[model samples]
Target: MRIAIAGAGLAGLSTAWLLDPLHHTVLFEPQERLGGHSHTVTAEVDGHETPIDLGAQHISPTAFPALANLLDAVGLTQDLIPVPLSTTLQVHDAATGRPEVLLAGPHTADPGWPRTPVLGAAAGSLTALVTRAAEWETRDVSWERSLDELIEPLEVPRDHKDRLLYPLLASFVGCDIAEAREMSARAAMAFVLRVPPASPDTAPLWHNLKNGLGSLTTALAADLHHGEIHPGRGVDHVRRGRDGLDIIDTRGHHHHVDRLVLAIPPGEAARLLEPLAGTSAVCAALGTFDYVDVTVTAHTDPTYLPADRRHWSTNTITVHNGWSETTTWYGPINGAQAFKSWTTHRPQPPREPLADATFRQLRLTPAAIRARDVVGQAQGDGGVHFAGHYLQDIDSQESALLSAIATTQRIAPDSPRLTDMLTRAPHASDPPEKG
Candidate 1:
């Protein structure tokens, strides 16, 4: 079978890698390079060129079995290095103009971050809610409530919810607290509960590649012997015929294939699928998703962090002000000489004076949340499969990989490698709700 995959992100690459070698596979990417948002760049630090990931970084070794297995298959397991699970969250008090250190621990020690009385009480209430909700989650009935609706019933003080709980949830989706409130309750629960436990003496739970995530893509690309990768080529239109699928590139080159996989964002997918029949429902579903642009800056300045060096853990810092909450998270690179800081904000005009190093990222908004059944309905008819982070309603490396695996299996159900990988992969398990 001749298969054509769109977008050279992790999903597209993984699809090509897992398909049977007998099939003719080709990947079409609009960018000149691969890896989509999993990009890595080099910065000169202390007379040495060190790689820093300007895009997606960090993965949970236990939660993301598909990615772990992929690294093993590609012989890049040696490149995986564990990062400290500890974090130092700075909760900014708007009235006082000072941020309080909620959690502070080095990568090696457990930081018993304390919560305020109100916040602690609120946490207990939320735990009870989740415990009850879990029973509903396993049943046939739907529990598709927004985060805001769930919080509304809780008796916690508004201050605590806005300051602590909301900011924490906002960080999960890379959106403001107000926006996160609109997110599905299930998604917020999944993200928050998946976070590894942190203690002063706990070992690292998250891992990153020694050279950056780009190395994983490079390795996957190299392993594709039977497929062709067309960089700098964008698919302008996709039309399904009686026999096969037809794809037209920006340069007007025509190609035909027996099957097609779209690994790009939903908006772009909606545009391409609009011209094809039996895709209206899927296209309209794609159009329902809302997106925001985020900017991450890498800099040598530690001044942007807290005054005390002891509180400089590579965790998230959340600034709370009612509904408009912003999170600032950092990752140390090149022995702490440089760091990457990410800011999640609503779309707006570009700021004048770019940071020393910056990368712009696109993410989903809360309105995009849908029940799993709704997602199933959006899976367009016959040979056209959709894969990417948005499919899962969350943006993360693990989400993207899992989406790819699911899409691949849907297309090539009989492929042994793909089937075996899925069978052995660990399912996403939620952590015990905190009281």
Candidate 2:
């Protein structure tokens, strides 16, 4: 059977890798290169050329075993290094105009580390909320009900609740916390608590690619046969028939295949497959999932950051915009600070204004942050399948790998070699060709 898989990001490549050989497979990507949001930028540093990641700077050990396994399979595991999480927060006082280094630590006892003192303040309320959220039983009730039940009862400080918790929740849902359902937050809190701090010497518990994250995705793409990949092609439509599928690209080219898999974003899938029945709700839900705009400013010089100061900030930070606010994070990787933010409101034209020198200030404002959720599904029709990092539950390579494994299972049953080798995935019968 000939199969066409759209998008050459990790999910697309993984699906192609898993299904090929057993059946003919061709994967398309609109970008000239693979690895959608996981590409790297090269910079000259200290006389030699070095690369920096503007996307996904860190990986947690707790939630990334599947990602790690994929890296190991592609022979890129050695590129990983344990990064200590050194973070210092300088909270600004609006009225007093003073910056207080509220909390600093790679260690509980490090000099200037205000672990307990800061926690004793209103920050203590955060630990309580986080603790309670994580400890709660997870079941069906919609994420919306869970959040109101959890947060409303907490006696947290008003400013902290507004400035800190709400923003953090926004980042989690990629939408306003009020718009986000509570089930998602509950699931997120559980994931955060599972990973304990790594060590006293190392930064908080996170890992980075010694080279760059692109290594893992690129290596996966490289391992596939050249004939298997078709880059720079955006799939515009999918035609379902009794036999199988006809995937149409943006250029009006159609490729017939016995199986079709969509490895693109959920929103993209929703748009392309809207004609199919049952997909409308998934599409509607997908439209609700927001994505944050990320402007990764790479400071050319590491010296710009004070040496005495710790480079890590909160894994997430919330800042006030003119009326509302957004969330962001900072990480020093490959000798540069990466500032990632997502905004509450979508810009008028959905433009990357950061690419323009005149609109550079937008990158600093809280409103520049983008919505971050990517929803994908098999709800549209039985013939088409959806998968990606966003669809896999979280934004990590492991989730991408899992999505690939799951999508492959849905699209091609009896093709067990890939899953047996890379993932212990469950088997599913490919639906009978739509009649």
Candidate 3:
């Protein structure tokens, strides 16, 4: 089968990776770089080149083993580093214009978390939320429930809900705090339920790529032996012919293929399919995706962290107004104050910052579940298939890889390579969100 994949992100690359040795494939990406969210920027710090990832940096091996299996296949599993993503928070007072130090991160071994009244309530409430999520894992009530619905009954401080929980969930969904509160309970808590939050009482549940997550994407591109990957050029649109499909590139060039996989975001995919024939269902599914604009900046700015150094955790969140900004510090990695900061509303990139990038991140909701159902029905419709994180039960690099596997399984069930991959990978059929 001749397959044409659009977008050279994780899903597109992984799809081509699986089908290439068994079939001919071509991938088209609009950008010059290959990875989409798995971007890593290299910076010169004291004559040493350090890799900084601005997006999709954390993973859970036990919760999402398919991606780990993919890493093993690419020979990059050795680069995986177990890192704790503990968080510390600071909230601004609107009337007094003062910042209050909230719960110090558990990573600090701060024994005072249980002593503070607000922190104590928050801790017990958070444990309740996690327990509720676990129940949802065994129950069916999460689909109709929103995170706000769950948080309202906890009766914790408004600070915990607005500043900490909202920001964390927003970053995960790539939405604003408002949308984060409104997102489905399942989307918000599935992550917390499967991947344990950073805590002094428990083991670390997440892993970071030592060389940066870009290593995963770069390895996928480099390992592709039977496919043509076109970067700097992309498929602008597609048309259906009597025999197959016509893939029109941004440069007005045309190529023919038997099948097409859209690995781009929802908005991009919907635009490309506008000119295609018999795609009403696919278009409906893609249209259900909602995205928000966000800027990610990487730098050595100490100001991004909390005022007191002892309270610093892997993540430092500052709450101003009704919104929150997050600083992801990698100081423990190389013993420096290197950080990545992102927010829906916050400071612009610093002048001459190490790296700055903007993105339209997916905001998952109950509608996404419906969208996925629609796309699932139209998987092989008119030789058009969809694969990406947004289409999964939860949004993450692991989900993106799972999307590729699910799409490829539909594309070619008898390929020897696919058979071998599934056989070698444990829980290969289980979705990542299910843990």
Candidate 4:
């Protein structure tokens, strides 16, 4: 079978890698490199170079079993460590040169709880919401409801929900407050449930892939002997022909393939299939899904974090211009120290930007979840296939790998490697809902 996949992200690369043994596959990636979100930039830190990932940085092997197994199968096992869950919310008083600690999460830098009435109330409400969410999540029927609807029953104060909780949820989706409010109730539950039990006492064994995702993508691309990767070539559009599908590249070159797999986002897929007849069903389903821009910048800027050094944590969320943006303490290099910021959420951009890239993430709204089901139902229709994390059962790297395996099985069910990976290999045990 001849397959052409658009977008060279994890999903696309995994698909091609799985089918390389028996099938001919071609990948169309616009960038000069192979990995999409699995990008890495090597920087000299304290006279030693360390690879800093700007996108799709970490994955917990325990939670993402399928991804772990796949990496093992490819002979790429290196580093694993517990996920750091330290998070803080605070703002700096520029004139005073101090930070007013607003609120904190588990492993937050300062364990002392807030005292302000509103902050105290919000802390209490967070506990209530977590308790309330845990109760309803097991019902299974709760997922059908919107987050706003679920919150309505809680009677959470407008101030508490807006000023505190919503931004936290928005950060999870890499979106703004308005987008977060529309997320599914399950989306919020997923975040709270994934919270690790009281720190060092009873911690969950979720490990981060410390070697960086670039190595993973590189290994996958290197293993593809039967596939050709076009680095600078991007699929402009696809049109259904009498024989097969015609893929028009950005360079005005057309390539015909027996099957076309759209590993890109649903929004991009919908736009690509817009010209085709009898695709409205899929396009309409795709339309229900939306994406928000998340720009990540690698910098050594300390101004992005709170002014006070005590406020620095693994993840420091600064609310500036009524938007919640995160600046991560990436490294401890002397001059090569890296503190990456998600600049899209902030109106004030980080200074001395080292490297910047923008990515689009699927906003998990109730409508999008419903649309996920619809898209799942329409897979393998009209010689076109869908492959991505969003189309999988869970939105994670494990899901992305499973999606690739499942899509390949549909495309080449007889492929022995695909069959082995599905039947004999370890798959992702359901991930604990973590924000």
* TM per candidate: 0.81, 0.75, 0.91, 0.86
Per-candidate clashes, comma-separated = 5, 23, 0, 0
lDDT of 1 at 188: 65
Ranking by lDDT: 3, 4, 1, 2
Show pairs that collide, candidate 4.
none
> How close to the true structure is residue 403 of candidate 1, measured as C-alpha lDDT?
86
Off by over 4 Å in 1: 92-96, 102-107, 110-143, 198-204, 320-334, 344-375, 378-382, 423-435
The lDDT of each candidate is 0.66, 0.54, 0.76, 0.72
When 2 and 4 are scored with lDDT, the better candidate is 4
Q: Candidate 1: which pairs clash?
A: 109-200, 110-199, 110-200, 110-201, 111-200
Estimate the Cα RMSD of every predicted model relative to the unseen true structure: 5.5, 8.8, 4.1, 4.6
Q: After superposition, how far is residue 118 of candidate 1 from its true place, in Å?
A: 16
Clashes of 4: 0
Question: What TM-score number comes out for model 3?
Answer: 0.91
| Deviation from native of the Cα of residue 151 in model 1, angstroms | 3.3
What TM-score quantifies how close candidate 4 is to the native fold? 0.86
- Candidate 1 Cα deviation (angstroms), residue 127: 7.9
Tens digit per residue, CA lDDT, model 3, 1-435? 789999988999999999968899999999999898888998876677888888778887788788878877777676776666676667777788776766554652335332222255556656666676677778777575787877777666776677666766665655666778878888787776786655545434477777898998888888777899899899987999767888999989999999999999987888888776677777877898777777888888767565667667777777776566778887655544578888457644544468888877776777777778887887778888999998777778888998999999999987666776788866333222211
The residue-by-residue lDDT of candidate 1 on 90-139, one tens digit each, is: 67666786777654444554334331211235445545555644644565
Top lDDT prediction, candidate number: 3
* Candidate 4 segments exceeding 4 Å error: 91-99, 108-123, 155-158, 198-206, 331-336, 345-347, 424-435
